[model samples]
Target: MISDGVSVEALTQWQEATVGSLLSQALNRWPDRAAIRWPTPTGLKTLTWKQVWDSAASGAAQLRADDPTPIAIFAPNSEGWYLSLWAVALSGRPLVPINPALTEREVRAILMDSGASIVLAARDYRGRNLLEAVARLNIVDIQHLWDVDDWISATQSATGAIGAVAPQSTFVIQYTSGTTGTPKGVMLAHRACVNAASTLIATLEPGDDETCCSPSALHHVGALIAHALALARIGATYVMMNEFSAQGFVEAAASSRATILAGVPTMYSRVLDDPSFADVKLPDVRVLMLGGASIPVTLVSRLESHFGARVAVMYGQSEAPVITATRLDDPAWMKAHTVGRALPHREIQILGVATRSPADVGQIGEICVRTPVRMVGYLNLPDATSKAIDDEGWLHTGDLGALDVEGRLYFHGRLREMIVRGGENIYAREVEEVIESHPRVAEVAVVGLPDSDWGEIVAAAVVPRTGATVSADELSAWVERHLARYKRPTSWRFVDELPMTASGKPKKFAIVEWFGAIDGN
Candidate 1:
């Protein structure tokens, strides 16, 4: 076993078993430990490992009797939601969890692509009746396991060979947002899931006695399996939060007695904004993780002082999601400036965009990754999949970054979002990072807008810090001091707030409506 912390020999014992096998073992091991939690108007709801397993087993038995294939979950984050994931795994069937906030059209696209035989629609997820809604769509065969209780006992009589399902079998089909064109279903095999989980668990080094909390979505690997499942690998008690709220998080962490509560940059901002957390007792909390997007140095400094020596910064994506993460002991210079080195069994190479060769120290390039945990390409799109995953199996992550000699990577931005100002390429994330560091900026988003003179001009949207003066010129000058001339934003707008998805990444396309309404141009 590699000595990181969560060394369970999962790779050797159940390496060939399905995800359900892992879930089953985890549940059996900690039948009394709390596994999931959700929010209520008045308080929070929680589930123990045994209760979750029993519920999932019932769901799986129902699913197997119905179709013995993929089951799609069109819902939000909750205890039932997580139970559905385990249930699908237990049945040795693929599970599809769609974002609840997506439009009808977007939702339809996912349904069509997955070819799901059943959709698990229960009531009270963010107050939507997903069951009736999908039946209204009348797209594919859909069924509510809740609606059929008899199937559970009937199928359990024949729950044979399921626990032994091979790990290399397709475990999940998560669709990437179709921003570039159409959404592609990423098929992750059982082996891939196990490897990813093992690597992440080893990296975190959670103690067996640790209690963990994840407030992010489970559909996203960064939160789903990365932090939550990783902690669970070593028998750490895990508490789930339905949605992110500053007061709710602090209360839940204290309530569940969680030692590690994972958060994104936005989560940290909310806690800082929460008045109740200022004087609240947070003794159980130890590690505060920041990921999904880069953390501002100013925010880091403020959070470090406020949270007291446990804030860890990380940078990740859907592809190779656990690329680099900071350790609590990292020095200020490394912690503030870079995404830490790769987790165990993972390797990264920053190749110059033009050369496709290893970039010189501090030179930016397209970040490519080779990990045993990598997904089994985008489903059914062979040509598109071929372009992304090469013959050598390296996933071309389409994200740009610079590698320091110490092997830490500083993220630049998405390859498609790069701005070309009079033929000079500029990474918007690099510029936005600088803008976000300004004292008066609460949040910021940088994008390239059409400009007749320069082809594509760097435009930014800034959310001013609580009742503070923030001018376009001042922001532009701040970026200029930190970035090259062409990398600075040329045009900008200051707003009361910026639009974001539940995951806290700025929805760049959605901002058009808000920005257009504000400027009337």
Candidate 2:
């Protein structure tokens, strides 16, 4: 076990020290400093540390007045949802954040499974009225928390339940996509939350003036909890966009004067593709953190040109809080490719025959990690939870990689056959699902093949759905705009039928061999 030498996590009373408490301390220390900001069609709104705390306290008080633990929140990225996240933790209540992009049916499943009592959703999102969907959740109180008027009224009511909550208390219930079956909710305990935040803050060394804007899904650990709270803990500024829009992101970075920005590869791809990038002067952006999918080498140069070569290509996952991150201080070449070094408090041991250990120099194997920030367990999935976190407490990351003699980490390949096209993860089954949704699509399988430009491009093979005439171009354009662009298949192939076993799963590798490529175009 590595000693952190007295920091955020690993301290005894951590569970009681809620993310709310961390915000409160920031508020007291820098009462006037801007804690969070977002640009609206009308204007930009900034929240001070104190203001964020009080709003959270108001939310905690309101939710605690009714339920003692685990309040629910469902909304696109917004200040209201962020406040409620803090409020729930402060009142010693766990927060359950559901995916806003999920269809109503999908949304309902998570709410019911997590047992979230109070649900806070937006009344309006991009002019789409989703309150009806929130209403259907049948949660205890389907309050529109983003109602600026309602939130302001609630915060000013002197209803904040002022108290200290332990860090070990349940803070949030994060649900993993149940592709194999039903999605399981992961209850992140307070100690784990503090440990995750402290691990990142101490290693990343977020400065007091540092500002971070992330396009990751808010319900995921990267945004709602890990990156968001970690920013507050370090007294840095936080910024959110209602949704990830390429043009909107460029504007937000400049509008908020954010110094630090983290986003998946797809988010940056559009920015790079735009001819206007040369004109969109995001001058204040000092550090750029890249993750989710493989970072494009082209992007490294573009980012260097844009941000003065201060880029960090990081590798992370929801299961393990940020495991590796590079810095602006590292060699520019290393910053462009390597996933940097293992986090300060983490231990890495490559598992397999050729992997003699880090001292072996050129070794390749799965990346197993032991850290203070890992989650307690996945909700209602004991067998899976046990498999994920071994008895030794080392997290067996599915990614394959190697450590050089210089102690830098280099990503090799994946143990699991998951597709990452433009930073949006396209689970084979998930894409194979949508392709089969077409009326003409009879059978289909999806895979991530190599691409020189966008890293891995999404490709698909389909067997027309029984005499239905669905042309490749039409299907490509159809699926393109339907799903998130990153998940959309760039290429497609129509076949007589798909190859499957007696149990029925696309022999993805074999399909790749037969079809040559999965192309929709």
Candidate 3:
């Protein structure tokens, strides 16, 4: 059984470790164990621990020979992407991952911001020629850009020794989703990533033979720390998906006999919506992990019943990889409602917005976290870093939540997203939960629209289930039965789908624009 208390010994051992050291340890302990499984059009490709180490060493040598500065990877999830990540990690240079879904302009902005001269990119992903597109940008800062396949081939044939790196050195410059504003480069040190992955490994206690099916993008922290690094620490196998499709995920899970499945709420909903999901039997799956967004209670219950697996919920951000997670044995309500208590070696506090002091139990306030897993700072933005992490070492998360007497956290909503209708505050999450509970609703995103009379009014963008229809009057009456009049949505838009980020969170800014376009305001 997992203990709630922190493990001092584990922290002491991992506090000064680098990703290279972790790779070495895995190589020594589990030389013959399967480290990765990549499904291709031809067949399944499996790599042993020793093979992964050799490939990483070769790639690292090539990187050290070509450039000494931080490198960037622009590709979808694939064997080439994994090899590139290991190459950068072993080379003692930071890696900047750019989402494949981003536009050329967005990609150029990140490259310029990160100053990554060497970029290993895919030749083509989905339908776009990523290499040609990046070449078209012709950013002068980008000195060397190699197609991912060519780079892998060149690196695999080369050989060199791994460089020595400090534990506190930055390993990755992860960019935020930029849903609220321009994306910031979050500097994550080797120690922080190692410690965070170790903490989660201890909590999950995955077996050596376990296989995890992950469909989340490798660029996001959820896939990097939680699934990839965590699985590598234990020498387990992880199945990679280049793109997420309900049919693809179900097929992969069945073929791999996966023990753990990880994804965001939207991915889970899609899998359940797939017709083949009802016919498949995944008896080997033991845990279904959810992260990246708020999970609806109904979704949790449905996942548990469908997969016959325990649902484990986690909450985190790019600034802090993972703050809290629910255990496998947690009660159903606790798993569905709360984000669980703070993880080991982490402290969570609800700070009063006005005074910036600790709020009383069950009182809503801005969520603050003090943990070793936090990012060093925003790259090249000292003022922004200071504003995010205070002098007291507390990282003000800007998310509003409350803690119960037992220390379990209940997330309310984003502090900035709160709606103040004539001085009364309304949390978007509260209203969303009610609408999602309705039988006809598939998903909903609530926002605060500008109103001249009430200052700001509640607005909702709802996606109804396929072939199911419900009018505004029906939803208004449904919400009225559960929420106060002030909290109910005054404006509604029945969209086929909500705009979403790559990591699966709804894009609130885009929804607000939709409403604005309709109102001509």
Judged by TM-score, which candidate is best?
3
Q: What is the lDDT of residue 149 in candidate 3?
A: 64
lDDT tens digits, residues 97-184, model 3? 9998899999988998899989888888888888888999988878888987677677667866777988999999999986556789
Across 1-521, the per-residue lDDT of candidate 2 in tens digits comes to 12113343343223435676677778777788888888888867899888887777676666666656455666677777777677767778777877666678887777667666666676776665566676765665343334522553565675644666776666778775432234567777776776567656555544447778766666776666546777776677888777777778888888788888877655675576566675775778877777655444456666777666377666666566667877657866676557888765677777763343332555666778887666667776789888878888888876666688766877653555567666655555445545655555545667677787877877787765333578878887777756877888777777775553211234556666665633342
lDDT of 2 at 415: 51
* Candidate 3 Cα errors over 4 Å, as ranges: 1-14
lDDT of candidate 1 over 1-521, digit per residue (tens): 32233354543233555567666676767778766666566766767778777877876766666665577777667656676777777777887777776666777778878888777654545667666667767774544434222333344454433445667777788776433335578888877776666555654545566777778877665676665556546556667776777777887887777777787787777677656577764676767777777677677667667766466777656555566777777876677678788766667888788888788898888888887667787777889889988787778888888888888888877777788899999887778778888887878888877777889878888887655788987877787788888778776887776666554577776564456666666
TM-score of 2: 0.74
Off by more than 4 A, model 1: 1-17, 40-44, 125-127, 143-163, 178-181, 512-521
TM-score of 3: 0.96
Clashes of each: 2, 20, 0
Better of 1 and 3 by TM-score: 3
Question: Cα RMSD (Å) per model?
Answer: 3.3, 10.3, 2.5
Q: If both were scored by TM-score, which would come out higher, candidate 1 or candidate 2?
A: 1
What TM-score would candidate 1 get against the native? 0.90
